[model samples]
Target: MIVNQFLVLGALLFSIGVYGVLVRRNAVLVLLSIELMLAAVNINLVAFGAFVDDAAAAGQVFALFVITVAAAEVGIGLAIVVLIFRNRSSANVDELDLMKW
Candidate 1:
Protein backbone atom coordinates (compact mmCIF):
# COMPACT_ATOMS: atom_id res chain seq x y z
CA MET A 1 0.00 0.00 0.00
CA ILE A 2 2.73 2.43 -0.86
CA VAL A 3 1.77 6.00 -1.67
CA ASN A 4 3.94 5.86 -4.76
CA GLN A 5 1.86 3.03 -6.13
CA PHE A 6 -1.28 5.05 -5.77
CA LEU A 7 0.38 8.03 -7.37
CA VAL A 8 1.49 5.93 -10.32
CA LEU A 9 -1.96 4.48 -10.79
CA GLY A 10 -3.49 7.94 -10.75
CA ALA A 11 -0.98 9.21 -13.24
CA LEU A 12 -1.63 6.32 -15.60
CA LEU A 13 -5.37 6.80 -15.43
CA PHE A 14 -5.01 10.53 -16.03
CA SER A 15 -2.78 9.95 -19.04
CA ILE A 16 -5.26 7.55 -20.57
CA GLY A 17 -8.07 9.97 -19.97
CA VAL A 18 -6.14 12.76 -21.62
CA TYR A 19 -5.45 10.58 -24.63
CA GLY A 20 -9.10 9.63 -24.90
CA VAL A 21 -10.22 13.23 -24.74
CA LEU A 22 -7.76 14.29 -27.36
CA VAL A 23 -8.34 11.47 -29.80
CA ARG A 24 -12.03 10.64 -29.44
CA ARG A 25 -14.51 12.33 -31.75
CA ASN A 26 -17.74 11.45 -29.96
CA ALA A 27 -19.14 13.81 -27.34
CA VAL A 28 -20.19 10.97 -25.09
CA LEU A 29 -16.72 9.44 -25.23
CA VAL A 30 -15.25 12.81 -24.39
CA LEU A 31 -17.46 13.05 -21.34
CA LEU A 32 -16.43 9.55 -20.31
CA SER A 33 -12.81 10.55 -20.64
CA ILE A 34 -13.42 13.56 -18.44
CA GLU A 35 -14.97 11.32 -15.84
CA LEU A 36 -11.91 9.08 -15.97
CA MET A 37 -9.69 12.06 -15.39
CA LEU A 38 -11.77 13.12 -12.43
CA ALA A 39 -11.53 9.64 -10.95
CA ALA A 40 -7.76 9.78 -11.23
CA VAL A 41 -7.77 13.06 -9.34
CA ASN A 42 -9.92 11.55 -6.64
CA ILE A 43 -7.50 8.68 -6.27
CA ASN A 44 -4.60 11.06 -5.84
CA LEU A 45 -6.50 13.21 -3.36
CA VAL A 46 -7.36 10.30 -1.12
CA ALA A 47 -3.84 8.93 -1.33
CA PHE A 48 -2.32 12.25 -0.32
CA GLY A 49 -4.84 12.81 2.40
CA ALA A 50 -3.99 9.46 3.90
CA PHE A 51 -0.32 10.16 3.56
CA VAL A 52 -0.58 13.53 5.29
CA ASP A 53 -2.56 12.07 8.15
CA ASP A 54 -4.62 15.23 8.39
CA ALA A 55 -7.01 15.42 11.32
CA ALA A 56 -9.80 17.00 9.29
CA ALA A 57 -9.61 14.58 6.37
CA ALA A 58 -9.33 17.50 3.98
CA GLY A 59 -8.29 15.33 1.09
CA GLN A 60 -11.33 13.08 1.31
CA VAL A 61 -13.57 16.12 1.80
CA PHE A 62 -12.17 17.82 -1.26
CA ALA A 63 -12.51 14.60 -3.20
CA LEU A 64 -16.16 14.46 -2.17
CA PHE A 65 -16.64 18.00 -3.43
CA VAL A 66 -15.01 17.03 -6.72
CA ILE A 67 -17.30 14.02 -7.04
CA THR A 68 -20.33 16.24 -6.48
CA VAL A 69 -19.20 18.73 -9.07
CA ALA A 70 -18.35 15.99 -11.53
CA ALA A 71 -21.82 14.52 -11.17
CA ALA A 72 -23.38 17.89 -11.86
CA GLU A 73 -21.09 18.36 -14.81
CA VAL A 74 -22.09 14.99 -16.30
CA GLY A 75 -25.76 15.85 -15.90
CA ILE A 76 -25.40 19.16 -17.71
CA GLY A 77 -22.96 17.84 -20.27
CA LEU A 78 -25.14 14.89 -21.21
CA ALA A 79 -28.14 17.15 -21.51
CA ILE A 80 -26.30 19.38 -23.93
CA VAL A 81 -25.00 16.41 -25.87
CA VAL A 82 -28.44 14.92 -26.11
CA LEU A 83 -29.85 18.16 -27.41
CA ILE A 84 -27.12 18.43 -29.98
CA PHE A 85 -27.58 14.86 -31.10
CA ARG A 86 -31.32 15.31 -31.45
CA ASN A 87 -30.84 18.41 -33.53
CA ARG A 88 -27.89 17.28 -35.63
CA SER A 89 -28.32 13.48 -35.63
CA SER A 90 -24.64 13.08 -34.84
CA ALA A 91 -22.50 13.45 -31.75
CA ASN A 92 -19.19 14.04 -33.42
CA VAL A 93 -17.35 16.83 -31.66
CA ASP A 94 -15.69 18.20 -34.79
CA GLU A 95 -19.01 18.57 -36.58
CA LEU A 96 -20.61 20.66 -33.85
CA ASP A 97 -20.99 24.29 -34.81
CA LEU A 98 -23.72 25.51 -32.56
CA MET A 99 -21.57 28.39 -31.38
CA LYS A 100 -20.90 29.75 -34.81
CA TRP A 101 -22.75 32.79 -36.07
Candidate 2:
Protein backbone atom coordinates (compact mmCIF):
# COMPACT_ATOMS: atom_id res chain seq x y z
CA MET A 1 0.00 0.00 0.00
CA ILE A 2 2.69 2.43 0.95
CA VAL A 3 4.73 1.52 -2.09
CA ASN A 4 1.77 2.10 -4.33
CA GLN A 5 1.15 5.50 -2.76
CA PHE A 6 4.77 6.46 -3.15
CA LEU A 7 4.77 5.39 -6.76
CA VAL A 8 1.62 7.37 -7.44
CA LEU A 9 3.00 10.49 -5.84
CA GLY A 10 6.23 10.15 -7.76
CA ALA A 11 4.37 9.81 -10.99
CA LEU A 12 2.30 12.86 -10.19
CA LEU A 13 5.40 14.88 -9.43
CA PHE A 14 7.04 13.81 -12.65
CA SER A 15 3.93 14.69 -14.60
CA ILE A 16 3.79 18.11 -13.02
CA GLY A 17 7.39 18.68 -13.91
CA VAL A 18 6.76 17.68 -17.50
CA TYR A 19 3.85 20.06 -17.65
CA GLY A 20 5.94 22.88 -16.26
CA VAL A 21 8.72 22.25 -18.72
CA LEU A 22 6.33 22.22 -21.62
CA VAL A 23 4.37 25.31 -20.60
CA ARG A 24 7.13 27.53 -19.29
CA ARG A 25 9.55 29.32 -21.58
CA ASN A 26 12.00 30.88 -19.16
CA ALA A 27 15.31 29.04 -19.10
CA VAL A 28 15.53 29.01 -15.32
CA LEU A 29 11.94 27.84 -14.98
CA VAL A 30 12.56 24.98 -17.36
CA LEU A 31 15.68 23.95 -15.49
CA LEU A 32 13.80 23.97 -12.17
CA SER A 33 11.10 21.77 -13.71
CA ILE A 34 13.71 19.34 -14.87
CA GLU A 35 15.09 19.22 -11.35
CA LEU A 36 11.60 18.47 -10.06
CA MET A 37 11.38 15.51 -12.40
CA LEU A 38 14.75 14.26 -11.26
CA ALA A 39 13.65 14.57 -7.64
CA ALA A 40 10.55 12.49 -8.36
CA VAL A 41 12.72 9.73 -9.79
CA ASN A 42 14.92 9.84 -6.71
CA ILE A 43 11.93 9.63 -4.41
CA ASN A 44 10.64 6.52 -6.15
CA LEU A 45 14.08 4.94 -6.04
CA VAL A 46 14.59 5.50 -2.33
CA ALA A 47 11.04 4.45 -1.42
CA PHE A 48 11.28 1.18 -3.29
CA GLY A 49 14.75 0.45 -2.00
CA ALA A 50 13.57 1.00 1.55
CA PHE A 51 10.35 -1.00 1.35
CA VAL A 52 11.32 -3.86 -0.93
CA ASP A 53 14.96 -4.60 -0.28
CA ASP A 54 16.76 -4.04 2.97
CA ALA A 55 20.02 -5.56 1.83
CA ALA A 56 20.67 -4.18 -1.64
CA ALA A 57 20.96 -0.41 -1.85
CA ALA A 58 21.28 -0.03 -5.61
CA GLY A 59 18.36 2.34 -5.81
CA GLN A 60 19.73 4.51 -3.07
CA VAL A 61 23.13 4.53 -4.66
CA PHE A 62 21.64 5.47 -7.99
CA ALA A 63 19.71 8.25 -6.34
CA LEU A 64 22.89 9.55 -4.79
CA PHE A 65 24.65 9.57 -8.13
CA VAL A 66 21.69 11.34 -9.63
CA ILE A 67 21.79 13.96 -6.90
CA THR A 68 25.47 14.47 -7.51
CA VAL A 69 24.97 14.87 -11.24
CA ALA A 70 22.01 17.17 -10.70
CA ALA A 71 24.12 19.42 -8.56
CA ALA A 72 26.77 19.67 -11.24
CA GLU A 73 24.10 20.24 -13.85
CA VAL A 74 22.53 23.07 -11.87
CA GLY A 75 25.84 24.83 -11.56
CA ILE A 76 26.61 24.64 -15.26
CA GLY A 77 23.06 25.32 -16.33
CA LEU A 78 22.77 28.46 -14.19
CA ALA A 79 26.06 29.72 -15.53
CA ILE A 80 24.85 29.21 -19.08
CA VAL A 81 21.58 30.95 -18.31
CA VAL A 82 23.41 33.89 -16.90
CA LEU A 83 25.64 34.01 -19.92
CA ILE A 84 22.62 33.95 -22.22
CA PHE A 85 20.95 36.76 -20.32
CA ARG A 86 24.10 38.83 -20.45
CA ASN A 87 24.34 38.38 -24.17
CA ARG A 88 20.65 38.66 -25.11
CA SER A 89 19.04 40.47 -22.17
CA SER A 90 16.41 37.71 -22.01
CA ALA A 91 16.20 34.37 -20.25
CA ASN A 92 13.47 32.79 -22.27
CA VAL A 93 14.63 29.53 -23.79
CA ASP A 94 12.38 29.98 -26.79
CA GLU A 95 13.88 33.33 -27.64
CA LEU A 96 17.42 32.16 -27.04
CA ASP A 97 17.30 29.18 -29.37
CA LEU A 98 19.72 30.61 -31.89
CA MET A 99 21.63 27.34 -32.06
CA LYS A 100 24.96 28.49 -30.76
CA TRP A 101 27.87 26.58 -32.17
lDDT of each: 0.97, 0.93
Global lDDT for candidate 2?
0.93
Q: What are the RMSD figures for all models against the true structure? A: 1.7, 2.2
Q: List where candidate 1 sits over 4 angstroms from the true fold.
A: 97-101
Clashing pairs in 1: none
4: Cα error in model 2, Å: 0.5
Model 2 clashing residue pairs (backbone): none
Q: RMSD of candidate 2 to the true fold?
A: 2.2
| True-vs-predicted CA distance for residue 100, candidate 1, Å | 7.6
How many clashes show up in model 2? 0
Candidate 2, 1-101: lDDT as tens digits = 36988899999999999999999999999999999999999999998888878676988998999999999999999999999999999998889656777
